[model samples]
Target: MKSLVLLFATTLLLLSGLKSQESSNISLIPQPVSVARGTGFYQLKDPLIISAPPQNDSVKFVANFLSNRLVNTKGGWVSTEFSESAGKAPIRLQLLPKEDNEIGKEGYHLSVSEENGVLITANTSTGLFYGVQTLLQLLPTAAAGHTVVEGVQWQIPAVTIKDYPRFKWRGMLMDVARHFFTKEQVKQFIDNMATFKFNMLHLHLSDDQAWRVEIKRLPRLTEVGAWRAERTGRWGEFTKPSPDEPKTYGGFYTHDDIKELVKYAAERNVTILPEIDVPGHSLAAIAAYPNLTCTPGTYQVSSGERIMVWDKGTFYALQDNNLCPINERVYSFLDTVFTEIAELFPFQYIHMGGDECYKGFWEKNKQVQAFMKKQGLKDANELQSYFVKRVEKIIQSKGKRLMGWDEILHGGLPPDATVMSWQGMKGGIEAAKQGHQVVMSPNSYAYLDLYQGDPIAEPPTYSMVRLSKAYEFDPMPPGVDSSLILGGQCNLWAERLHTMRHAEYMLWPRALAISESIWSQPAAKNWNSFISKVEHQFNRFDAASINYSRSMYDPIFKAGKDSNDSLQITLSTEIEGLDIFYSFDEMFPDQFYPKYTTPLSVPKGAANLRVVTYRNGKPVGKQIKMPVIELKKRAGIKVKETP
Candidate 1:
């Protein structure tokens, strides 16, 4: 027995040594372009040095940022030196004189070895920032924490990596209008995505529920539009505001807050694209100034429920939220809004939301009809096209290009307009075919608001977008000019996300998948390998105190009735390693229970079916319990029980 124990201990030590010696399996989230493992590791110890080219403030800033991060994580003060020294420093950031055209300006070459210590070279500051992010990832996951974490080996694997993004416009859109996220929350989001090298932050600042950005000229836009009656329970199921009810549950970003956020994102190499949804999804604006609409009356800000009526083959929101195209006052309102938005955000494009403009009101109103007839407009679609063209001019006057949803393709495609294809890739393909630049944000894959795992086990959302599905998305569709594709983005519509925690739960792992999809090359994609990297990021997220879902561990349960009228249950998971187990009795499943090998039928005399997932003989996911009656309901068959 003593000899057997000695052998076991020896084997464990051998395995640990083997793991340490093995070429660093650095599971980078968005895999770098080229990585070659070296012989030695860079041990991060006291008095760690970081040097950059003299007078290079950007590199200096990065060094300081890293130094502070190390101090916070490792519980020690590590000073960074920006000036050139006689002795070689552990970390060196150098700016290359000539850019590598193939790698582009946002690419960097990183090398860490015994001979050179650690070296990062890039043509631009943005590239350097990304390189720093990659370097941080190379360190121990505990280095991501805010407080000091003991018993961690602060070491980075020695390697040489040449990395660059496949697309220039990787982004994430957060809708603050439906549910407001605090300025600090937004900054936290920006920081998280920046680590994954996402370059654009699309702020959906206005929608039917609320207006989330302050405009000095239009104070009521926030006073009346931003503040809505406090909502509880499921979205769209809230009680309607009564005469005595107070509107007290919403918030907006002050101009100062916006400026601070802009600066914060800019320093991280992220551009903020602010969307003041226009012509449609404008109920919040209409609530503030009712005259902007064709039907003039007092309009209360929506309490998170849309007023809809079944129209010609479709449902339409009947609050007359859409701006009246013929009303010059409407255009003036937009102009003022855009003028303020343009002054606040420094991005090149302003998203003029041209999606879902229910033209039912325009079709019904006599004055709008007369105006349309005067202009020889064929339908409300043409009227919307007219509205878009005028708004395009307004945005152009502010020295910004116009971007909108695919619904803008209805009447006629606006020239110089960039289309964000949200419905699906069909709009993106059409826009690319017409030579219009497009951002592919197909709802099927890019909508983070959708359910990632089984809706029963996870939060209630409309659709399923598994991590694999998100990873499989190719923004540049076949037969379309790839050059016209300005990369892709994942959108988190905040209707279902009541808190920052809920938003974070929905964004990660899947967002990690999106980061790889948009940033890594198409040829470099490997689903199995990406899943491994995602697991590594989960640890980093844990250290950072960020909320992320582990719903991927849950098995997808499908129920159906066999031809013999017996209820059948099929269970599977997108992740490869999990083993599904089940028990018909009320007790929890264990290894002793039947391991799911085939379609499971309802056991005789069983009252309920319980399913659980395990990894390496240990339970890892939520145990799912479904009643026999519920299974019958799902299978759409009535099973009479025998006494």
Candidate 2:
């Protein structure tokens, strides 16, 4: 009881002191480039204003926002000098490029100085628009009661700012094959990537569930794999039939659709990397061309129940699984498939599915063993390595690089091959140590298919990894050279994710948190600070009508109450401006604006205290799981007998 009293007192003191210091401790510096607590705000002081004459409405509008942020102080001015003759101007502002002007074509760039005014330019309207976003970040945050318009506030600061990204390959990966997303949805994703300054999107187009891209040479590849009659069972158990099966599900992109998406992504400076699995996740291939298998037998559209050792569809027969008798027909089939891939995707790197190839087939086949002896291959695992090497040569000969799951590293990876680390950092670490580039997408952090929260609330998957864990990830493990870390990706493999809503449910707000991890510097990261940003971002998602998991906010924000008398809660979601309302008596909550403080109070004798999140006078999105709280205090005081 005595210890409990002391602990309560300590917590109360700490929270009180933090609250007192909150305002004064806020840095007076221009924009805080660190993790945004709630919303990232910028304030301007003096000698920074946009005074340039108006060109297009977009240019002028963007300039106005920048001027407001850089001149956020009580009195300051920023002028944009827009003219054909930018003579003797300290800063020159231009609009969408005319064939001759080169300032804004690629994206937005803002050059600022304490002595001179700020100049901003972009090649397109959107570029200038993004420059404004950067300028706002460079300014100062608004004080209490400042009005916000369209998610931006005018709190400008005076200073010189020069900023840009360090690497050109900042990227993320999305798998639409497990569950197909429409072209429009893909474009929406491109827009989302643009908001965070991410520059690449690796699309895992082909998987065992479905094949997405259209290959003209092999029409059935798309006809059979691109669309499935009905999806298989859940991730772990593939016994029961899918209850909500679509009679005919799946779709593929036409050549024109691909071209449009390519142009769209290029406009946003995002390169699309596509993956086509081979050798093993080849049930899709066999279904399309039964002749590709060693047995040359009939194959069905995979029900997610693949034969581990041998099947009529796979190269190794059920009983005669071995590499001894090298199959001439299988090689020819693979050659044609690779040739088609080389023609379809212009990306330098191509993913060949090299994971989960069961060795049981080879162990049983005497012909395979005989061929292995003939070729002097040591063991079955070594044979898999040889298989990968052969494919690597095929991809390399056509001027492309081969990328595979870290499983490819099992037998022995070719020097030229790259690996996507999914199991853990071990594959990436080994690959980098051997002078090969690696993309870290470890499942502990990057697997988005796993429930972002408790399975009781959100149905379960094979993994229990959460969203906050994803945000806390550091791509390069300690002691590993960062040079070998090419980039990172959050993989959304669809096993339970059957529909587009399920896809969005698994991705959103979580992917938003990950965007900062990949783009922002390490020192700028803070779990608490990010939650504040998400509060407002949640409103943004609502405004966009994106259907995401409601339970995801718990761990990311740590919103539950402690056993102490008061609610010692932490707002972990990145949304800003959330009004937290709570009630100990369970009647309803007393509203608190921007409720990111600790140890909230509930009415006396309150049995339960629950909080609801709101934005802008309305419930922003789904209500979170209320944390269990108690109102008991210490029992240390003793009464005299006379009393």
Worst 10 residues of 2 by lDDT: 28-37
lDDT for every model?
0.87, 0.61
Compute each candidate's TM-score over C-alphas. 0.94, 0.67
Candidate of highest TM-score: 1
Model 2, span 1-643: residue lDDT tens: 9999999999999877765543322321111233122222243434543444455665565556555544443344456555565554544566534532432243455655444444566565555555555553334333211233334433433333333443345566777776778899889778666656666788877766667787777789888767565545555355423434442677888767877887778655677887877666666666676665554455544454433433453533232112222566666655666776676667788788677665766655677788889888888777878888887888888788999989888768887999889878898999988888888888888777887764435656755666678788767677777887877777777767766677778876667666666655577677766665654455545645567665543323333345652444454443345566544455544344235355454445555545566667665434434434322222222223334
List the candidate 2 regions with Cα displacement exceeding 4 Å: 1-118, 121-161, 231-247, 295-297, 303-326, 550-552, 555-643
Task: Score residue 536 of candidate 2 by CA lDDT.
Answer: 44
Top candidate when judged by lDDT against the true structure? 1
